[model samples]
Target: MTGLAVVGVADDTDGPVVHLVTADERARHCPDCGARARRSKDRRVTRPRDLSVGSRRPRLVWAKRRWRCDELTCRRRSFTESVPPVPPRKRLTTRLRAAAGAAVADQGRTVVQAARDYALSWPVVAGAFTSHARAVLPAQPEPVQALGIDEIRRGRPRWIPDEATGIWQTAVDRWHVGFVDLSGKQGLLGQVGGRTAQAVIAWLADRDQAWRDAVQYVAIDMCTIFKSAIRRVLPQATLVVDHFHLVQLANQTLTEVRRRVTVTHRGRRGRKGNREWELRNRLTRSAARMRGEHVDALLDELSNLPRVIGAPITVAWNAKEDLLDLLATARTGNRSAICCTGSTADAPTPTFPNCSA
Candidate 1:
């Protein structure tokens, strides 16, 4: 824009049409001091394709000039001249750099495509975008109460070679997300939680002390590592096991009991074993397929099973109900409780019993 002026357009023997621009000045500046100076040595014209201005193709036509600094305190003389809109060391224009950044941020396009579109070299486009994103994106804020921790996988390709035959297999991996509360709202905290404990701990360590102190309660699944991380990070906070995890555990226990009962019933009627097994399978599958009110009704019917094999089923059902009761109790009284032995403990630091059902 400064030195070059577009003159005319001509079609090349190759496909693309090219625009010609001419450089006018021999002015130069000191690279170290950024002080204006006259050209001490003149170089050949370096014409590089620049960003498009409107519909017209733009070209950068300029000479690289070497200038000598007059200041004695300066480290050395003989520095390259600076371009106005383009970065000091790079050949691409400021507008092209911006377009490349937008491509990465907004369109989720690869750096290579962005570079090609802007007529810029890969390094120039990449460095500018990276630098700009680092400057503009805000730092992670601290969590106040109810932080959630999770993990995710980064950069790993979807496919990997199997160890046995060296055949490519699709891999399923995860990365961790740690949510922090900046506003002290319990509900607003920790939406991102993943499988890794170390990632959760590191995220907690990044938060400020004031935010840690403001936390009164933390709701998490029964992940031992997550619980341990919470204990280390926020020792004073109340820990409440999430209801969803408890329900899942109860459902699993119920399903197991159903499987055992179905197996025993089929054994008793030994004649049509295959047909009986298939029927039982259909029933089990139907129970699994049941949703919402139907699931609740099935659970209720399971709860009414006679005291023979139904003891475990009843226990699992009651456990689920008790879990819901605890959640309601906490919500009504605004007090947290630790679940232990199919019951809620009132103690601040309650010991949880090893009860699967």
Candidate 2:
């Protein structure tokens, strides 16, 4: 519509067709001789695909004039008029291709998905997205300070026959490790094939020495493979575990202790009406969310059970809550001016009854 004016509209079985012409009579000069083209040979109509109008498909019909370049010394013959929105000899309009590209890139749609939505082919949509990405995205990556490494589960494992040995082996690497720039504007760095040390090492090795040296701190889950790889590649970087994984480890430990205590004391699985079972959910609840009286009751009941039965559960629950409290401190201490319990490094180590600190 930038340089085109709609002359007429017609209905078709598939959708609507719009007849368009150039809005202005701009002077056209011969490309080689630089002489104004005054004579017109003939006119032809070309149809270009467009985005859907309303809910129906739309097509643009353009009547272009073929101008004969009358430059006697020039080697050019004739040329046709084209606009920015509708390029010459292109089946799809420029606006339509740009729209499809934006749909695939900005909207996070797959190539096939965008193709189906726009009634276009798969390769066309893919090309559109790739072009859009290259045009808008930066050529070089930004420097990173803190890096985070984590694994994501892909999907159900599949079995395929091995070429060398005819036996089919189950796909063991169902996980992909993703690296992220924690401190910079760049979000995700990249993802590698497997969750092994070799995959992590390979990705780290691909980066230049300056990139490895710039990475001062690395955050990762309790993944030994990642730990070993970073140690070998970026030895100067400090490896720290995220609070979410720390909380997960604490919860898992608490659950194991609770299950073991229940089986040993009650001689069966935990069920309703049992004091421990009833308090299961509340046991992990943060101290802020716990009701004072219910918590006091829990303490009174659990404290009375013999040391052999109640001691383990109480110790495990206390440890979990303590870690949660420490995590809360570290998380908020940087934001708030007031620091809770001081730095954990200088904090007193937890000492249990009759156990050396």
Candidate 3:
């Protein structure tokens, strides 16, 4: 089918074997120098793996030629023949490698899974995907307008014992810093080893000066290290703090409030059948997400509970709702009246103790 002459075909222990050779033998040009070589140095045999044909996989054994380059000026050496379906220094055919790469990259199969499907070793499949990625994907991109910085934990924390004191020091094994380009379609820029200022600055420093100058905005969390690094390298760029962390902070504050209210009112940790414990999750949920009927039902349920139990929980719930409202209104670019002004015209503040600012 590939236009190569089929010298022989036989059944082997490994399935069907197809012996192939080049149909037309012609003089080949020297790879280093363009000069043609007419002399044959030797002939070699290569067995490259091909794709499976239906349920049976055919092994391709190719008879290859070697040519002697007679050019005096050129670094003269004997070069081997390169034919269709098999490139130089490769044991697998082009189609076989491409199939493995597509399984891993395009079809989202793991390396082990792709290896099993292709009937190849795991390392072979993984190397094919790596080569395909390098060939097809762009190495460097134009400067990103908006970059987002985040970190991911590598593994669970470990405790190292002190030799003398016998006290264990807690340590996190590995952390990676991920940079994302928010300006264009290419989602992830790359990742660095550690989540420190030095690691980020070193990655940025590798880019050209023009690329660095083109960066306009950076979005990061409340980490001072990330902010400090960005301020030094891209001073002109605007730093926008990520709002997701703020919402997380608000949720944590609500939990703390719930715990404190539980301790003060009941003189113990919350347990089953407590109204505050029952409605804990509902309390942190935003007012905008709650239906009118649901909110009314919850408020009625709270009003009927003991005043000491219901009052503190209501305050925390209202504060959480207010924070969500503030964030939502800010997102839409619309102004809403602040609820915490110390005046009769303003609404009463929800008594969350730790969330003043």
Candidate 4:
């Protein structure tokens, strides 16, 4: 007999069922009284589901041994024998339960899907996955140095009927703020309800003094509310604007310039056949990323247009390109590059000829 002794065997409609008992049996000690008992109290049998053994799902009917404490001086009662494969009051073996947990957590499948895959109940698989997650998750969060804050839209704008005023009131909150610990193994710390300074302040104030002191920097978008909140709560932490929002600002500037230039020259809104309108994306693209011949040809085309259309578009496009160059130079930590770029940008350029009637 291996760890399992086959007491009997039977054939079921699904597969072969085996009745098993513990193979290794020696002197048993009462857990509470520390007394060895040779006398038998009672016997019981349980059917526990096990993992598939060679393409056949094993159903085990386990005959268990129960013992009574022999010491009268100790406040002891009868206890049941524990087995390695199955725990008390559980219908699935440990290995089977672990398989269900792995199906849900590791494979990224839903609990319902895992239940169907493992031939177990939904609650059973879900509970096992939850327990596995709790056991594997870090006992305590690692310290965070740099934090990131951002907001995401939750749902559409909604209106609720107001009975007292007989009018519909618009819902207020449509955004959620996520706080992330950039320096920690787990990026997300928590999420708050609103994007207001008060909400952020309250969350930071809840942390202990040491945690607040440990924070070295905070990265956020160009939201004044978040900046103000960090200033009030974590005053020592350096506030840095995130890169995505900086790119968004550049895009907004390009869009405004394009719209203004379009309306000024074309005397109407931009549409097809408008050269400036068609090259909006090309105008925003970095010069290095664009094909040398194509970008030069496009700029040459702009220069050949009328002074009013060409001048404004050329200036804005040059500014966008120069901005990218300046950012790249700054990343390399070269002071000379910064000074040279600044000088080049400030230098005077040939002005557009007056086309006044």
After superposition, which runs of candidate 2 have C-alpha atoms over 4 Å from their true positions?
Answer: 1-11, 16-50, 53-97, 104-116, 120-131, 156-174, 334-357
Residue 112, candidate 3: how far off, in angstroms?
5.6
Q: Flag the better candidate by TM-score, 2 or 3.
A: 3
Pairs of colliding residues, candidate 3: none
**Cα lDDT of model 1 overall?**
0.57
Tens-digit lDDT string for candidate 1 (120-219): 6688768867767776665644444444443445555466899999999756344445453422443233333345566567766776888678676666
Against the true structure, what is every candidate's RMSD?
8.7, 9.2, 8.0, 10.5
Tens digit of lDDT per residue, candidate 3, span 1-357?
353679899998878999988664433777788778888898999988889999899988888788899988889688887765677799988999999988898999999999999989988998999888877787786677777888888766677998999999756547789988776667788788777899899988888888888877787888998999999998988777666887778778878887887888789988898877888788777767889999998888878878877776678677767667665544443344544554643533222111112
6 Cα displacement, candidate 4 (Å)? 9.8
Q: How accurate is candidate 2 locally (lDDT)?
A: 0.78
Model 3 ranges with Cα > 4 A deviation: 1-6, 20-46, 62-89, 103-113, 121-123, 152-176, 192-196, 300-312, 330-357
**Candidate 4 accuracy as lDDT:** 0.76
**Candidate 2 residue lDDT tens string, 1-357:** 787899999999988888998774552555457677899988989988988878998777888788899877888899777677876678888778888899988898888888999989988887887788778876645668788899999876677889999999766568899988777657777777677899999988888899889887788888899999999999998787887888888888887888788889889988986777777787777766778898788777778766766788889888887777666554443424333564655543221121110
Ten-residue region with minimum lDDT total, candidate 2: 348-357
What TM-score should be assigned to candidate 4?
0.59
Task: State every prediction's TM-score relative to the real structure.
Answer: 0.55, 0.65, 0.68, 0.59
In model 2, state the lDDT of residue 311.
84
Model 1 error, position 183 (Å): 6.0
Q: Which runs in model 1 stand beyond 4 Å of their true positions? A: 1-27, 33-63, 66-79, 89-92, 99-143, 155-174, 180-202, 218-221, 240-244, 256-311, 321-357
